[model samples]
Target: MQRSVEGQPGSPVNYSCTHSKLNLLLNVNIYSSASPHISLLNLSKNREFRVFFFSVSKVTSSNNRHRPGRYSFLIQFYAVTTASSPMSASKCTRLSGALVKQLLDSVDSILFDCDGVIWRGDQAIPGAPQVINLLKEKGKKVFFVTNNSTKSRKMYADKMTTLGFDVKEDEVFGTAYCCAVYLKTVCKLEGKVYLIGSDAMRQELEAVEIQQTGVGPDHICGKQIDWANVPLDPEVKAVVVGFDEHFSYMKMNRAMQYLSQRDCLFVGTNRDTRLPLEGGKAVPGTGCLLRAIETAAQREAQTVGKPNHFMFDCVASQFGVKADRCLMVGDRLDTDILLGSNCGLKTLLTLTGVSTVADAEAHQKSGCAERQGMVPDYYVESIADLIPALQG
Candidate 1:
C-alpha cells in the first residue's frame, strides 16, 4: 500500500507518510480555485486493495499562522495482500482511466478570486506570490476578479505588486468598471448620475463623461445606497446598484421609492448574492440589493456582472480574445461559473468562496446538468491547485 499527503509546498505540513512496508510520493499541484476536488491518481490498489478514506482539517496554531494554512488531505490506499490473489491488475487499470479523464479536461487560462484565494484584505495568502509567478512563467494567463468596488484598478495593481505578485491594471476587473462601460454604451445618459460606491466607482462614471448630481438629477449612482445620505428627487431617471457596506432598511425604502417611478431604469454592477469576508463570514453583495429593488418595484434590473453575456463580450472585445478560448474561473456558481456557461466559454468553480462541495453536489443533483449558460465543466479548491492540472 502507498499513502500520500498532497497540499501546497513548504506549507506547515511537511508531507511525509509512515507505514511498515509501503512507498509514498507527495505531488504538489496548484490548481485554480475553479476546481472543486483535488484529484489524485490512485495507483496503490495494484498490489492489494483493502480500505480508503478522505478527510479535511484546518491547521493548528503550532503551524505557520498564515496563508495556505496547511490543509493535509490524506489518501490511504490500503491493500491487504494475500498469497492467493497477490495482484489485482484489473482494478488498478480501471482507476487509471478516471484520473486521466479528469486531468485531460484542464485548460489554458486561470481566473482567481481576490479575497480568500489570494489575500485577506491587504495581506497575501501564503504561497500566493509563488503561485502567481509560477503561472506567469509557464505562459499561462492569470486573471483576478473581485466584487470589491471600493478600490480602483490602479489600487489593485499596486497592492498586488506590493504583495510580490506581477500584476497589471488591465488584468484585474472590478464590478465598477463593468457597470461604467454598460452605462456609457447602453443607457447613454449624458446629464447626471447620483453616485454610489467608493471613489473607484465615481472615477469610472466620470471617465464616461457622465455628470454627477445631488438631487433632482437624471440618474442615481448608488453604491452602499443604504448608508449614504442620498438626496431623492422626482426627476431621478435611473437607480444604479453596486456593493454597499452600510445596507439598511431606510436605503431599501429610498431605492424602492425611486424605482417605483415609471420609465426609470434599474442597473446593478453584478448580482453576487454574498461577498466573502476574512474569517469566513458571508455578507450581502450587489445581488442582495438588486433583489430588494426588484422585489419592491416588481421589475428586473439590468445586471452587469459575470455570468452576464455583456461582461464577457466586453472582456473579449477589450482583450482581443475569443469567448470559446477563454476560461472563466470564479468562486460563485451564480456569477463566475454562469458567465462561462452563458458566454459559450468554459466554467470552473472554486470552493474557496461562497459555495462548497455539498452545495455543488446539490446543484448537480437538482437536474440542472450543464445547461447552455449556467453550468461549470470543473470544480476546484483554489487557483493554486489549477496550474499543475493545466501544465499536464
Candidate 2:
C-alpha cells in the first residue's frame, strides 16, 4: 500500500518530519515483512528497485505477534551504499552558501538534467536560466544530460533556448543521441535495426546513418493470430526500444520474432517506467514499452540511459571531464541521483521535480546501496535556490 504527503512548495522533506516542511506531494510505499527475513523495497513514484533483507525475528519490538495495530515484524529500512561513500546515511546535507561556493570551486564540470531540475513541462523554473548562464560566465563547463529519449539533441537545445537558457546542440546529451552512439560505437551494427521509438529517435539513428524499420503506426490485422503469416526481416540484427506512442502488440511480436533469432541484439534508451506529467498525472514511459517487447522476446534489453553508466560515458568520454571533479544536478533521484552516484560524481538533488527530501530520508534509513545511490550528497529546495549562491 502507498500514501502521499503534501508539503511546502519548495522545502526539504523528511519521511518523519512535520507535514508543514514538505510542500511537494510525494507518494511513499512502506513494506511489511512476514518471513524471518524482512524484505524492504523503495516503492515510490520513480519505481526505484532498491531491495534489501534483514532478520525480522531478531528485532526487539515490544509487540512481537502480528495484530490489527500491533505489528509482529520489526521493520528497519536497509539502504544500498558502498563502504567508500563519503555521504552520511543518516542525513542529506542542506547546502549552505559557503558549501555551495566550495562545491563550485571543487567541480570543473556541471551537468544538469532537464524536465524537473531546469523546468517542469513547458514552463521554465524561475532563475534556472540565470544559474546555468552564470556557471558558463564563471568558466565552468556545463552540459545537459537527460534520460528523456523522445527528443533529439537539436530539439532539446531548441527547447532550452526557448526556455531562456543559453543552450547549444553540442551541449545537449539525451538518451536518444546516446543510444545512436552506443549502436554505432559499441554495438558496431552495420545491418538494419527494428526500432520502436519516436521520430526523434529515428532522426538520431538516421544522423548516424543506421538503417531501421518500424517507425510509424502498426496496422492492426483482420486476423488476431497473424504472427505465423507475418514475414520477418533477417537483416534486422538489432531491436532498439525507446519512447514510441505507436507501440502495439504487432510491434512487440515482430520485435520478439527478430529477437528470437538469438543473434539479434536487444537495446533500450532508458528504464524510466513513468513520465511525470503535469497536474500529478502520469503516463507509461519507455520502460513499459521495452518491458512488453522483453516479455514477448523473453530477453532483457541492454539499457543505454541513466543509472546504466552509459549515459555519463557519453559525456565523460566525449568531453574528457573527470567524474570526480564534476557535479550532477537534477530533480529525479532514481535516475539523476543514481546516475551521479554510479559515475562517482557529486550529486545535488533539486526538489523541483519527482523526489522530495522525505524520499531521501527513507533511503537513508534503509541502508540499501541502490536506494543510497538515489540519495543525493546534498539537496536544495529547488534549482532556483542556486541562483543566490551563484551570485555570491
Candidate 3:
C-alpha cells in the first residue's frame, strides 16, 4: 500500500511511502533544491510500525521567500511478538540520509561533546565545521558540552572559532564552568576551594568570585609523616577535582586532608576515564585524578558532568530547553548516551570517538537496566554523516 504525506504550502518537498510485508521505502522529492530520492527502511517481518510526524521550521527574515519551513517524518518499527524482543530495547540504528533529516527536524536544540565529536586535540575533524555551521544556519540551537575541565567557556569558544566553527562563549559548557556554577548556586559554598585541576579551572572558579588555591604543581617534600601532616587551609571548605597533568602523591594527600573535614564538600568535573584523541590515541582523563582523590578521602564525589543530570539542568535552566526536544550527540556511550537517557532526550553516538557498535551491543544484550542507558537511540559513522542531510 502507498500513503502520501504533504509538506506545508509552497514547500518544495513531498514524501510518499510504499509499505510491503518486510520493507518500507520512502520517496522524497525536493523539487526546488534537488531531484527525487528514495530512502529504504527495513521493517522486521511480522513487526508493527508506528510513524510520527514532526514539523521543523526554519527562521527566515521577511525578505527571504525562496525557502519555507519543512516537515520531516520519524518512523519507529517494533517487534510486538515478545517483550524480550531485541527491538523492544535500545535501537542503536544507523543514522543517515533521510533518518538524519528526520532526527534533526525532531529537535530544536543539539548538544555536542567537544573532543572526539567536533575536534580532537588542536585539530578539527574533517567536515565538522561545515556540519556545525549548517545546523546553525538551519535555525538549530547548538551547544558544546564537554567533560574536559582544562578550558573555560571563553577559551573553548575561542578555540572553536580558530577551528572554523561559529561558536559563542555562552554556548560552550565545559565542566570547569559548570563546576564553578555548581559550587556557587547549588552548594552555596563559602570560603575557598581546594582545587586539584588546571589553571582554566581556577579561572572559572575565580570568575564566580570563588577563591581557589592549589593550581599548578605541588612537589613532594620531607618525610611520609610530614606529608601526612601537610598544612591545611583553614578557609578551604570544598575540594574540587578535575584534569591535572601534574597530579602527584603530594596533591592527592592534600586533597584528602581538605576532604577529611566533617563539613567539607567534594565535587568532581566528570568521571570519563579516557580522553580519546586523533588517530585512535588516548590519554588518562580527569576521572583518573578524581578517583585517586576519592580513594584517599574514602568518599564519593558529587560529579557535575554528563550522566549526572546537573549538566543537563544547567543547560535547560539557562536556555529554557525542553528535554523532549533536545538531542545529545557524543562519542562515548557511558557519558553522552547515558546523559541523554537520564535527561529523557534523544541520543546519537558517532564512531569518530570512543565507544563502538560492539560496546553498545553488549549493553543492549545485557539484561541489566543500568547498562541499557548507555545504548544510544541512534548512531552515525561520524557527525559528518549529517552533512549530506543538511545540504539536502
Give the winner by TM-score: 2
Count steric clashes of candidate 2.
17
Measured by C-alpha RMSD in angstroms, how accurate is candidate 1? 20.1
Ordered from best to worst lDDT, the candidate numbers read: 3, 2, 1
* lDDT of prediction 2: 0.73
In order, candidate lDDTs are 0.56, 0.73, 0.76
Q: Rank the candidates by TM-score, best first.
A: 2, 3, 1
RMSD after CA superposition, every candidate: 20.1, 13.8, 17.9
Report the lDDT tens digits of candidate 3 across residue range 330-349: 99988988888766577899
lDDT of 1 by residue, 98-191 (tens): 4423433333555665776677677886666777887677676777766677777788889999999999988887778877777676555444
Model 3's C-alpha root-mean-square deviation from the true structure amounts to 17.9
Give the clashing pairs for model 3.
Answer: none
TM-score of each: 0.62, 0.77, 0.76
Candidate 1 Cα errors over 4 Å, as ranges: 1-109, 214-236, 246-254, 369-375, 387-392
Question: 1 or 3: which has the higher lDDT?
Answer: 3
